[model samples]
Target: MNTRQIIIIALLIIALVIPGSSLLGEKEYPKFLEEPWDHSPITVYIDEQNTPPHYSPSYQPTVIRALQYWEKGGNGKLSYNPVFELANTSDADIYIMWVENMEEVTGAEEGVAGFCRPMIANGRYVHADIVLEVGDYKGYSWQQYGDDNMEQLVTHELGHALGLGHSNDIRDIMYPTYEQRENLNPLLVQTTYPLIVISILIAIGISGYLGVGWLRYHKRRKRLENELLKEMK
Candidate 1:
């Protein structure tokens, strides 16, 4: 092909490639996807002493709201009390604690924002511990995980506590990574799969159109050359 035609083809290919790369997302697998909790309205005990950074009386309610987010997200499969009972008993269903660092959660753990460890007995869940990190670290501004970020993380951990698994879809609150969504504690998921499908179809249609046009152009050019040669002959 001529230089101009080659340049145009290269530009189209690059434009298609970059967007597909961005659309490609990491597929994270869930570690603890067991059976659903056997009971409804599971009990949760919060360690009030190790509260989120900049603790205030109002923070507890926000945390409760985070728990309730699951109730709505559960869609009748699971539920938690709107009111968090006081931790008078040691055997609460779920225990949420805030640690100063990942090291406290696990001796050598680093770079993780939080994690959920489930207690299993006789192939069933007994309890779960969910820890959130709020401690300051040098060169790590991770302590700043606040607002929707922290609340969403809370819901995600609760999902684990309920024997749920991580979601490959980033729009899901149960996604492994900490993603900031437009809406906090989403009950309905808007997926990109449909968009991806539509884009592929459009790209294919475009390519087919371009190919047909190129063939027609060559055919027309050959016809013109043949007619010119006939006249000369």
Candidate 2:
């Protein structure tokens, strides 16, 4: 082949070798995934004394809702079905408490709503402690940020406890700064095998029907010829 034809052939081979899915840039966020908790239906303990002022008991429902949101938001590699149970901090896989100085732990100049401390071992998270610091922000509370905003913040911190890191997309719930409610896209699944199985069954049924018709036609033809020959003889 000429030089130009050889170059064209080389380009075609390279294009065929590369996977189309890799070009799409679909990747899960990091941290919790490294050492995800193996247990299912994990329980979280909420400290009654460590709640935001005017937020205890009344705002507890919102915490449950946030846990459910993160549970459904996972990519299925790690499963979370968190059940909130009231208890002392010592006996808990996860703790949801309030802290007056949010900036001290998070190192943010302002608007540090909440943060989490994950206890990791063997490349997986064993437990975590989350703190919400609504008191640190002036004029901010469940009344000011509203139920929706609190839910967003709780969901974000819980995600960290479950082994997820921050995301660059502001819309994602895992983002460092909570701007909006967001969820990760579920992993894509292939339906090709089911479709192929259905097509094969349909082809077999049609072939069986056609074979039966052909046999009946030939049998009738033979009987008619035999009668005609008897009459001619």
Quote each prediction's TM-score.
Answer: 0.53, 0.54
- Residues 81-110 of candidate 2: C-alpha lDDT, one tens digit per residue: 544444555567788876544665556455
Worst 10 residues of 2 by lDDT: 183-192
Q: Please provide, for model 1 over 1-233, each residue's C-alpha lDDT reduced to its tens digit, 9 standing for 90 to 100.
A: 57887677667667766665445332223323235355655678778765655444444565687876765554233323333344645578788887656565555344566667777666556788887765436584545555566676677777767655556666767777742221221111112333344345445545564676555555555665564444333
Please give the TM-score that candidate 2 achieves against the real structure. 0.54
Off by over 4 Å in 2: 1-28, 52-56, 74-90, 104-108, 135-144, 179-233
Per-candidate Cα lDDT values, in order, are 0.56, 0.56
lDDT of 2 at 178: 48
Cα misplacement distance, residue 208 of candidate 2 (Å): 63
Count of clashing residue pairs in every prediction: 0, 3
The alpha-carbon lDDT assigned to residue 33 of candidate 1 equals 27
Those runs of model 1 whose alpha carbons end farther than 4 Å from true positions after fitting are: 1-34, 50-58, 74-87, 135-142, 179-233
lDDT of 2 at 33: 54
